[model samples]
Target chain A: RAHSNPFSDHQLEYPEKPADMDWSKLYPYYYDENTKEMTKKVTITDIGCGFGGLLIDLSPEFPNDLILGMEIRVQVTNYVEDRIIALRTNNVETKGYQNINVLRGNAMKFLPNFFEKGQLSKMFFCFPDPHFKQRKHKARIITNTLLSEYAYVLKEGGIIYTITDVEDLHIWMAKHLEEHPLFERLDETWESNDKCVQIMRHATEEGKKVERKKGDKFVACFKRLPTPEII
Target chain B: MSLIHPIQDIVSSEDGSLIFGIIKNEVVVFRVEEGKSQLVGKWVDELDRNEVIREKVEKEQARQIAENITKKRKTNDESAKTIESENKTAKIPTPGLGAPTVYSHLRNVTLSHGEKLLIICADSDKSVIIFDIDNDNKENVLQLKKRQPYPKRPNAIAISDDDKLIVIADKFGDVYTMSVDSDVKKIDGNVEPVLGHVSMLTSIVVVKDSENKKYIITADRDEHIKVTHYPQTYIVKHWLFGHNEFISSLSVPQWNKTNDLLLSAGGDRYLYLWNWGKNELLSKFNYEKLIDKYITDAHLASERFQNEENNLREYCVSKIVSLPSNRLVAFFVEATPLLIILKYSPEDNTLKLFQTMEFAFNIITMNVNNNQLLITLDNHESQNKDFIKILDFNENTDRFSTNESLSNNLDTTIASTLIEDKTSHIGSTGIYPLYTTINLKKHGESYS
Candidate 1:
C-alpha cells in the first residue's frame, strides 16, 4: 500500500531516513503505557500541527498508533518530514504536501470531507492561530460554524485539547466550547486525570516553548457530548 | 441497585463545617454527617416574603404619590412649598446612592494613563472607569463613565506611554480608543476612530522610539505584530511575523541604557524579542530549545551542539522582558516556567541566555524593575488561585530569588503590573494593587 503511488504526489523526497532521524528516541516521554498500545490500532490526526511536533511527540507515546500531522505550509510539512526521519520513529507518518492534510487543512472546511461522522476520537489544536480583531473574527480557527465541524468529526465523548498563552484567546476558546451544544467543558477531575495535559505540556513543541518563557499557558479541554437519546 | 441523589442547592461555609444561606427563602442549615437539612432560626416579620412584598408595594405607592405631588408642586409655587416636605419623605432607589454593585467574575483588566489620571478597563460591568491612583483617597476615586461600550467583551487595554490616549481591544477584534480624561461632557472630542486589524487584537503596547515618536505595537489573533506609528496613523510602519498562532501579550521594557526592547508572547508558546528602536528583530526562543538543550546536553555539551543546530531548530518563544543589568529575560510555557536570561553582547548580534529559572506555573505576564522580577501566572489549574510571584535578581552575583507576594488573581488568567515602586523594591516597583471594591448585586438575595 505504501508503494503503489505512481500518480500520487505523496512520495518521500528524501528516500533515506536520515541517520540522525530517531523519532522514537527524541520523544521517549510519549512512549508510556497508555499510548504504546493505542497507537498500534488507533488513527490519530493532528490539526494545524506546526512542524508536526505533537505527532512526533505522540508517535513515541502511542508508537503503534498511526499518527498523522496535517499542516498548511509545504515548508513546514517538509521540515516535519526531516524531523521524523532524524528522529527515526516508525509507525508515525505523514501525508503528502497538500494544502490540507488530515492535520494541516482548514479543518473548518475539509474536516467533514475527510472524516465521517464521529470518526475521530481525539483532535488537538495546539497553539492555533487566533485571529483577534472584529473584522478578523471570521478567520479564527474556532467559531460557531467550525465547532459544528468539530462535532461532526469527533466521536461521542471524544476530546479536544487546546493550549494557548493569550489570556483573551483562552477565554474566547472556552466561551465557544461552553456554548457549543455538542461539547462540554472537561471537569477539573477529568483534566487532572488525563495524561494529555502532560503530553501537551511536555511532548508538543509549543508546550516546551511555553515552559521556556515561563509564559502563562491557558489549557482548555472539551468532551464531545454523546448524542441525546430520543424520547 | 442504582442510587440516585436528588439535585440539591447546597451552599456551605468556606471551611465546609456549617451550611449558609437560606434554602427556598427559608432559614435552614444542613447537617453534613447526618446528611439531612433542617430549619435554623425563625424568619423575622420584616424579612418574610409577604411582609417584604407589602413593604415594597407601599414604597412604590409612596414614591408614585411623591412624584405626583412634586409634579403638581412644580406647576404652582404655593403647591411646591407643600410638596417639598412630601418629596423629602419619599426614598427612591437612586443611582449611585447605596453601595455600588460588585462584579465578581473579572475576566480581564487594562490600565490607561491619561495626562494626569489612570483609566481602569474591567470586564465585569463592561465599562471603563477612571481612578486617581496617585490621589490620597484612591479607594473612592474610581468613577465609572459611559464612553462607547465595547462592541464585544474587551480582552486587553493599552495607554500610550505619554498617557494621552487609551486603546481598548475586545475579544471580537474591535479596537476602541478614547482620551483618558474624556468624561460625559467631553465624550465627543474624546471618541477616536477604530483601528482595524486582520484578527482580534489580543494584546497591545504603546512604545516610543529613540526619535521620541510614539508607535502602537499591537499583536493580533492572526499571529502578526503590527507597529503602527502615531501622527500619521495611516500606514503600518512594519509587521513582525514569526509566530504561527495568536499573540497573547506584549511587554515593552522601560527606557534602558542600551535600548528599548519589545517582547511578545503568543499561543504558539514562543517568546520573541524585538528592538522597536531599531525596527529590527532581536531573538526568538521556544521550549523545544530549552528541553533539547537540557535533555541532550545533560553533560553540558548541548550548548555547543545547539550552537550548530540553532539554524535547524523550530522554537516557540512566549515572552521577553528587559532585566536590570542590560539583559533580557524570555519566558517559555512548555515544561516549567523557564526564565531564559539573555545578555546582549554587541560583539555578536545574538542574545545569549546566560541563566535560566524554573517556575511552577505558566507565566502570563512579568514586570522587571531595579532587580525585582514580578511574574503573573496563567491560572491553568483551577485549584490554585492566579498569583504574581516576586523574584529579586542580583546582577553582581547573578542570582534570583522571590521577594514577596505582589498581588494575586487580579484577573482570571493573567495579571498585569499596574504600578511599580522602583525606589525601595530591589526588582520591579509600583506593582498595581488589586482593587476589590466592585460590588455585584444579588438576585433577591443579601448583598453580602
Candidate 2:
C-alpha cells in the first residue's frame, strides 16, 4: 500500500515517475552527505530561480545553509534536477539539498505560504519582470505591499538582494526599500560584505545573460529592521 | 599624473589646448605634446584669492563701521553725518579693468549658434541665465530669464545643431522645448507629458535623420525610451523594450552618415544600440561579465572556486559611442569603468567585441570626435577631481594602447593635430571645450 503509486488509481494520471526521470541521477548530492545532518544555517529562497543556475552555484558556497529555489514551471524544475544530478556535489545542501528544494508555485502568491513569520534569512529577486505601466505597478515584484510581506517573512537583520539591468527598476526597488520603515538601505561597504551581491552580479544565470549582452546592471541591498518592541 | 585631482570642468581652447576647472577655483591648462599631456599651467587662479577674501571681509567690516559711525553721530553732533555717508560710499568696491574676483558658479553650459559659448548659472536665483563667453560686450552678456514652472528640476540641456532650439528635461518626466530665437522666451513646444516615472530625465538627444527629419529622443526614470518628431506633432514612433531600468544617458551616434543609430545607457547595467530608422535593436553589452573575466583569470579561477567555475563576467554597460569605422565602444561602471569596443558587421547584422579599456572611476559620459574617444569620468564617487580623457583607438588592433616610443600618447597627439589641422581648414572659432563636471560634494548638499 505504501509502495502503490498515488497517480495510478486516477483516470488521467501523471506518469508513475515523470518520463526519463532518473531519481538516483537527479539528486547525487543527497546521498554523498548521507552521514551528515542538514544544518539550518541560512534559509534562502530564490524567487524565479530559472533553471536553478543560482541554486546550484550557491549550494557549494553555503554547505550548512538550507536553500530553496521557487520556480513556476515543471520543465524548468526537471531541468534543474538533471543539472543537480550531473554535478554530483556534496556539503552543498539542496531539499533537492535536503536543505534545498524547488517548489512549483507562483512566487507572487506562494511566498507567504512557504515562509513563516520571520522565517527567511535571505531572499533574492534577480531581474524580476519590470511591468513598465503605472497600472501594472501592483504586478511588480517589489511594491509597497510586497515589501510589507517581504518584511514579514524576513527575520530581523534578514536581507533582500535585488539586481536588474533596468535603470527604472533599480530606482523603483531602491525607492520602495528606502521608503519602507521596516527596511534600511545598505551602503557600499555593507553591500560588499554580503556575498549575495557579488554572486547575483556574476555567478547568477541572469547576471550571465546580461553580461554577455554588455548591459548595465543596477544592484540594491536592504535589511529588514527589527519591528519596534511591542510596548 | 592620476588626473591631478577630480576635474571640476574641462574646456577646449581656441588653439586646441585643454583647460580643466579644478577644485580650488583654479584652471589647469594641458598642452598636447606628441601623444601625452604636457602640464603647461597648474593652479592658474581664475579668481584673485586674496582679493576675494579681502572683499568679503571688507564688506562686513564696513557694515560694522557704518553702524558705529551712525550711532556715534546720533549721540554726538550731526557734523559726522557727511563723513559717514562718504565712508559708506567709499567702502563699496569699484569696478575696474582688473578681472572680477568673484568665481562663476557654472550650473549648465551649452553651445549657441555663431559658435559662441553660452553658460547658464544656478547662482542667479535658479533663473535661466545665459552668458556669451566669446562676446566682448559685457553689457547684457548674461541675461536672466524667469524660471518656468517645471515638474522636476532639470538635469541637463541640449541645443539643436542650428542652435535655434533649446530643450531642457527635468528629473521628473516634464520636457520643455523652446525656440530661443525670440527674446521673450516661452515654452513654444514640449514633449508629451509622461507620468508614473518619478525619476529624473537623465538625457536628451536631438537626432536629425538623413532625410533632414528632426527627432527628439528622451530617456526617463520610467525606463521609457521615447522618440518624438519635432514641431509639436509629438508622435512617438516606437518604444525601445530592452532596458528593464531607468535610462541614464542617451546619445545619437554620428559616426556614420547613412545609419541613424541611437545609443543608450541605463541603470540596468546594459548599453543598448538602436537603429532609429528601422526601429531595430542592434546590440547589447553587459559590464559585470567584463569584470568577472578580469577577476577570475587563468591564475585565480582555480583558487576562487574549488570546482572549476565559469570565468565569465556580467556587466552593466553604462555608455555607448559609435566610431568612424562602423565600430561602437561601450563603457561600464562597476568595480571600475570598463570600456569594450565592438565592430558592427554588416554581413551578419551583429556586433562583435574586439577590445577593452581597463581604467578606474565610473565613466559618466563618452563621445568620439576626430578619431578620439573623449570620456568624462565620475570623480565624485572616487572623491577626486573629474577628468576628460581623449583615447585613440588603434585601428589595426581596435584597442586603446599608449605607444611606448612617444612622449605623449596617440590620443593626445591625434586630437591636438586634428584640432590644429581642422581649425586652419575651416577657420572656425575654436572648438568649444565639450565637457563639464559638477562638484557633487559642493552642490550635492544644496540639491538634497
Candidate 3:
C-alpha cells in the first residue's frame, strides 16, 4: 500500500480534456443543474494525498474554493472517499464536507488532463513517494519535466507546497524546483506565515506518522513565476 | 515482409526534381525530370566508407568501453538508453559479443526551406547529420555538412519558418533547438535541452500564428500535444489533451492558411483536430471503423507486451502529410497498406473523410513533394520496381491518382540505380525494424 509505481499501466479513468470533466458528481453541492455548470471549480489540489487528512483540514480553511485529493492507491483513495462521504452525511444539514473529495489517479501523468492551464491556485505535495533509489529518482513526484507540468496547471503566484520526512528526497525536490526556470523557492518567512503550508505541516497521515517516529520534517514551498515573454 | 534494401525513407526538393532516398545507411540522390528518373549520386554513412570516421568510431568505442564501470550486459536495441540514462555505450565487438556493429540507418529526413540541405537523423549514433544537396554536380551530390550527436536519438525534428532553427525532440523526451545557419562544427557533445515532456516525444512541428508568433507543438507517447512559445520554451502555452493513447503525429496543414488549426493522430481511435492557439479541440474524426480491416497481426503487441487477459492489437498513426493546395490531409497508420485521406472544413472546423486509398503493398513511408504525394511502398517481397509512386492531384476527379506511365519511367530508372548494400553486417534482417511507434505503449510491466 505504501508503494505505487507511477509508470505502471494502471487503468485509471480520466476525462479527455478539462472541459469534458464533470466535477458535479464529485462535489454535488456546487452543481447548478439549470446552467449545467459547477458554481466553483477545484482550485486547491492535494496530489498523492495518501489519506484525507490534508483535504479535510484544508476544506474548512478554503471553504470558498473547492479542494480535491488525488491518490494512486485504490484502497487509500476509497478510504478517503468513504471518510469524506461520512463527514458530509453527518453534517447533512450544514453540508460541511461537500468542498473536499478524493479521486483515484496517477497525478504525475494526468495532471493536465484533469486541470486546465493555470486552473489551480495551490498544489500540495504532502509527503509524496520519495522513490529513494538513485535509479528511481525520476519516479519522484517533483522532477524537472513534471515541475514544468505543475507550473502549467498552477496559476501565476500560485504556490507548490512539498513536505517530506526523507532528507534526500527533500533536497532532491528542492533542488529540482530551484533549478527550474518557472519556479522560485520561497523563504522560511513565506513558509511560516502561509496558512496552507501550516495546515500541510500537521495534516497528512505521513506527517503524523513522522511526528510519532520523531523524524525530521523538511518543507519546501515554491511560487510559480510568470512565464517570461518570447524575445 | 521486411524491407530488403529498398528506399527506406525519402525527401525531395521544392521543385520536385531532386529526390534524396535513404537506402540502409546511404543517402541516394535521384533527379526526376522530364520522362526519365536518373540516379545522381549517393553518400554512405562515413563510419563504413571513410577511414577518418571509422578511426574516430573505434577510438570512441574504446573510450566508452574503458569508461564503463560494470561488467558488460547484453543490450537488445536503442531503447536501452531511453530506459536508463546511464552510459550504455558498449564496446564494439566484431559482429560479436560486447561489441555492436553500427547500423546508422538514416531516418526522419527533411530539407531546408530552400531545399538546399538534406537534414537527417541517424538511428545508430543519435546524431543529426546534415548534407549539402548540390544541384549542379552530377557525381558528388550529397556532401556531408554536419553530424551533431546528442545524448538520445532524435525521434522527430522540425525547422523554423525561415529555416534558421532546427528543433529536435529526442526519444528521451527532451527538445533542443540548434541554429541551422550557424556552423555545426561542435557536433560531439551534449546540446542543452530546451523543453520536454515526461514521456517519449514522438513528433514535433514549428508553426507560426496570425501575428507571426512561432510556437513549437510537440506530441509525446503519453497522448499529449504541447504547444510552447518558441525560443522562450519555458512558456508552455497549452496542452491539447484528447487522445487516450500515444500521440505519434502532428500536422499543421499548409491549406490551413490561418495556421491555427492542427491535425493530430496516433494510437487512438480517431484523428483529432485542434484550434491549438485557443486551446480548443475543434473536432475529432473517427478512423477505427475504417482501419479495422487493415489492423493485422503485426499490429498486435509482442509477447513481452501482452497481458494475461489479451494481446492488445495496437497501432499508431505513423505519419501525416497535408496537401499544399486543397484542404486535404493524408495519413497512414503503422504497417498498414491503406492511406486515409481527409478534407478539413474551415467553416465547421472539422475533418471529413474524403478517400481511403488502398495499395497492393503496405506503405513504408510518405512525403508531400510540392502537392504531389510520394509514397514508398513495402515492396521487399517481389522486389517490385513500383516501390515508389508519386500520386498527383486530379482537379476533375477532386482526388489524387497515380499516373501509370510516369511511374513506369521511375521504376525503370530505379532498377538501374545502385547504392552499395551496406547491410551485410546486420545478418538476415536487412534493416532495423521499420515500425517502432507501436512499441511506445507500456503494457503494464510487473515491477513488483
lDDT for A28 in candidate 3 is 98
Candidate 2 lDDT tens digits, B1-448:
2222333344443333333233222333455544455444332223343454465567667766777778877799675666556643334455577654433333444435444544342321223434334233333222333234232345657788886667776644445665554464332122233211233456777777777777777776445565655643223344455565556667665556664877787556556777866767787755446565543232222233234456433223344556655456455443245667766665655567777776556554554544566565555343222345666657687477633333125234323433332211212222122222110001111111
| Candidate 1 segments exceeding 4 Å error | A1-231, B1-118, B138-148, B184-192, B255-261, B276-279, B291-319, B334-337, B360-365, B376-388, B404-448
lDDT string for model 1 (B1-448, tens) is: 1111110112233222223221111122222223222222111111223343355567667766677777877676476556545544324443375664432223333333322343434343344544433323323322334333443556667776666667777664445676766654332212333444534557777666666667777776555576665644433455565654557667775535444677777555455667765656677655455645433221222233344645432233434556556555545442235666666555654556677776665444454544456565533353334444556666567677654332232221121211121211112212122211111101111111
Those runs of model 3 whose alpha carbons end farther than 4 Å from true positions after fitting are: A32-37, A82-96, A130-137, A165-172, A179-181, A209-215, A227-231, B1-4, B46-104, B136-138, B181-192, B288-316, B353-356, B395-398, B419-427, B441-448
lDDT of 2 by residue, A1-231 (tens): 101111111112111111222223222344346644322333788887777777877776777676877665556666776666555454334333444556554555335434546778899898877776654454567866357557767888999999999899999889978977778999999888777778888877778989999999999998888775321
Off by over 4 Å in 2: A1-231, B1-5, B8-115, B118-129, B133-151, B180-199, B293-317, B324-326, B360-365, B376-388, B395-398, B402-448
DockQ of 3: 0.37
Number of the top-ranking candidate, with TM-score as the measure:
3
Winner on DockQ between 1 and 3 is: 3
Considering lDDT, where higher is better, how would the candidates rank from best to worst? 3, 2, 1
Docking class of 3: acceptable
Predictions' DockQ, in order: 0.01, 0.01, 0.37
Candidate 1 positional error at B158, Å: 1.6
Q: Give per-residue lDDT, candidate 3, residue B196.
A: 76
Docking class of 1: incorrect
